[model samples]
Target: MFSLRTISSLWRTSKTDLIVQCQQQKQRLSSATFTVHPYKLHRIDEGPSTEVTCTRDQAINYYREMTTIRRMEAAANALYKEKAVRGFCHLYTGQEAVAVGIEDAITKKDAIITAYRAHGWTYLRGVSLVGVLAELTGRETGCARGKGGSMHLYCDRFYGGNGIVGAQIPLGAGIALAQKYTNSGEITLALCGDGAANQGQVYEAFNMSALWKLPIIFVVENNGYGMGTSAERASACPLFYTRGDYVPGIWVDGMDVLAVRQATEFLAKMCRDGQGPFVMEASTYRYFGHSVSDPGTSYRTRDEVQEVRRSRDPITMFKENIIQAELVTSDELKQIDVDIRKQVDEAQQKSRTDPELPIEHLYHDVYANMIGNDIRGITPFQRHKHQNTSKPCNITI
Candidate 1:
């Protein structure tokens, strides 16, 4: 019905509008950007190097895992205050990124062992929140059958929450030895604190691991303070990465999840390639004291802790990055926080109701092969005759 000229004009106008729309969409897509924070990696001999990069999925997963750990530690703290969880309780509140990042770089076949601040690692390595909380509360449903408390939670590939400082290092090296003997291509992560780094056993383990070319990664989580003593006061040289004389080492920004992941990935590959042992000193901070008993304010000021929380909190920093990149919304992260809180709360309740380990189980699982052994009773002179039987010993403590 229209003239040819009019039809051409109409077609041209439609095409122009479509082009503008496409350009706008392109602009919107380009506006969303993600950047990883740069970290300096101090090698053993050479100068420090830097690297950073992360995917949207990796960011999201790290956020969730870190959030879960933060909430779980908070629940543990509350339970401890309420006298529900007794004994030595070490809360890994601020150091969540270290465990989460390291676990991300390894597989189920790889093993992990650490000092008492191990609840975070245990949960990340596939133990359920309920199991961890129950273990803290000394319930039978715990990962360690309520025998190993906060300092001794264990799972399939996780060796334990070792009570002795630096003791796990040698054990981790032994595990790596077995891995090499079997040619399983599995590496062991041996985690210790700055305090534990001073122990003689740590150096011995390092020497042995390096000599045997064992697949071990010695992770020193230098969290500033050892118990109440600051690292500056404790060690002459706080640069733990450099402690490995013969073994290669790197120092990373433990506060940055991406940095930890990248560094761990690179080191793990080196071990898998039969490059021998590597050391990583994760310079991190702890929000809580060494243990729940310590107020955490004796040496460090309240302002210092507050400033770290405000500026460098692993969860907060990661959340900001993801939100800024348009990968996720702040509201979505809030929902995740709420869900984690609920999950932790539910775990605490379940742990309270879970049955405590029976006294008769004290001597069970002690020996690989069961044998009739005499166990000391309530009185030193009285010995309890424990028979080698399939059933649990009926004798009560």
Candidate 2:
């Protein structure tokens, strides 16, 4: 008969050995090279091509980022439901691939501007999870200092979560123009939803961008519907990639992270090569409503939503691919999920306890230099002198 202490000692040794072996295997996989399967590009006109290489590190990072966005959006949905977040909260639940893939392909110097569905982009662009959650809850610690709310979050190079539909399109082009003027060699990614694609200003920006040969990549996230109206019912031409007649365009599977990255890389190169602006239509889907207030089911069926979620979820698809390639174990990915959930939970708790922005903040970031005019106070004709003398308040209000 074996002694109990001896048996326990043997079990511990075996467990340690197994753990060490797994770590060694993971390290080996991390250093290994892998090929990303290519997908045909639906090109409006022929352009330069680049091969996308997916490695263990890239897969792991993509998985982590996409999962983080998914979990963060889930937290935002709950916060909105609980009334902790208010005023036009748009969750980026199913469109993680578009943001993550773009960020992966571009450098930090490159700028990005997007519509209200922007939490994922903000996070990927270097905003902390706490900052994003705090912004949503209107806390003083928010990225926008509690003023922008869910519709406005910003980082160093990221422009905003612009509230107005189709507004960011022209604004993005303007940013690209500045980049070109400075000879920064940086490109700008201007993202808009399918609903905003038909706006007149977008075409005008496209024409100006093409004429000036600005470095801008117009990414239209075609998520099927524009609010409650289906894309089929809304636009005469649903293929947004082909909408830019003078500018070259490509259509890609937005659900596939690698595909999105490959397409973005190709488009970004074209812009850098002085080919002017390029258009990419990413065929994605939003799992949640346009906003928290929207039920998102009047025009679409519940089964249709469920089917997309099951078949084409970007996070799930990435996870499956990485696991199948033996780049990472299921347990490793589950651990990442567990860690992200805990991080989000902590951020939510902290945001709840953070103080709200003070009333005087309204007059703080209004101008670059001190203007001699008095801002109107609560009582009409009673004006308060603006005291802020900061140089170049370049922050987008």
Candidate 3:
């Protein structure tokens, strides 16, 4: 008979061996090919293949990034419940793959603009969690100096979220025009929700981009429902990708990160080759309400959300694939989750406690040339001075 202590010792040794074996396999892993759902095409000859491949390094990075976004959004939800974040707090809880995959396929030289559900996009576009969370909390250290709040957070070449629906479509086209005019050899990815699909301006932007051969990709992140209304009930034609009759379109599986990456890589090359102005409808889903004020369960059932999480969650599905491929072990992923939770928690604390911007900055960055001085305040009795200065200083005109 074996002693209890001896058996315990053997178990520990075996566990260590398993971990070492997993690590060795991971180090040997170069890349893995994944089969994703076929993309639905519109007015296009051929779409990207369903067989998507990514390197081990890329997979780890994608998992880390997507997990971080999810955790950040969860923290944001908690902060909103605690009343730390206010005034239109949109959480990117479920649609993380779209942002991470797109960024993976694009470069910093490329510009991106999206709707107000932009926490993920902002972070992926070089803004840190500290910057994004601080902006949500209206702290001085925010990306916008707390002036832009939740709906606006910008970085170099990355335009922040726009509040008004369908507003970013035309703006994205204009950015693409700038890119073409300056010969920047860059592209623009303009994203809008399904609700914005019906906006007349969206079609106008599409028409303009198609006519001018703008290096732009109009992306409709159709998350099934927008602002608590179902896309099917709202639009007579919900096939948003096909809405661009002249421009080619692809309806990608947004839940699959690798799929999004592959599609984006194809489109980006086409854009640089002056064959752009495509429409990509990422059929995704969001787990939260339209904003902090909304109760998401009112329109959709909890069971539906749970079903999606259990069956089609981007993070879980990716994790399963990599795990099955022996590229990573469960223990390694758990450690990553722990580390990300700590990072997000620490940033959340800082965002909640940081001081807000001073009142002197109220009128800052309102002018460039300052055509007139002594700008009037809310009422005629009060007047403020305008000095055409840099983006950091105050200007009132």
Candidate 1 lDDT by residue in tens digits, 195-284: 999999999999999899999999999999999999999999988888887878888889888778877888898899998698899989
Clashing pairs in 1: none
- Which candidate wins on lDDT? 3
Residue range with the least summed lDDT across 10 consecutive positions in model 2: 31-40
State the lDDT of candidate 2 residue by residue for 1-397, as single tens digits.
Answer: 8899999999999999999999988676774333343433444445334345577778889998999898889888999899999888998889999898889889998999999999999999998999999999999889888889999998889999899999999999999999998888999999999999999999999999989999999999999999998899999999888888877888888888888888888788878888769888889999888898999998899999999999998888778877876878899998988999999899988888899987877677666665576777789978876656334566432
Name the better of 2 and 3 by TM-score.
3
Q: Residues 1-397, candidate 3, lDDT per residue (tens digit)?
A: 8899999999999999999998877666777788998898887788788898778788889999999999999988888899988888988888999999899999898999998999989999888899999999899888887889889988877887999999999999999999998888999999999999899999999999999999999999988897988999999889988999999999999998999999999888999999989999998899888887788899899999999999989999999999887667899999999999999999999999999987866675566566677778999899887653345532210
Worst 10 residues of 1 by lDDT: 388-397
Best by TM-score: 3
What's model 1's TM-score? 0.86
**Per-candidate clashes, comma-separated:** 0, 0, 0
TM-score of each: 0.86, 0.88, 0.90
Root-mean-square deviation of Cα positions for candidate 3 versus the true structure, in angstroms: 5.7
Off by over 4 Å in 2: 1-28, 31-51, 372-381, 385-397
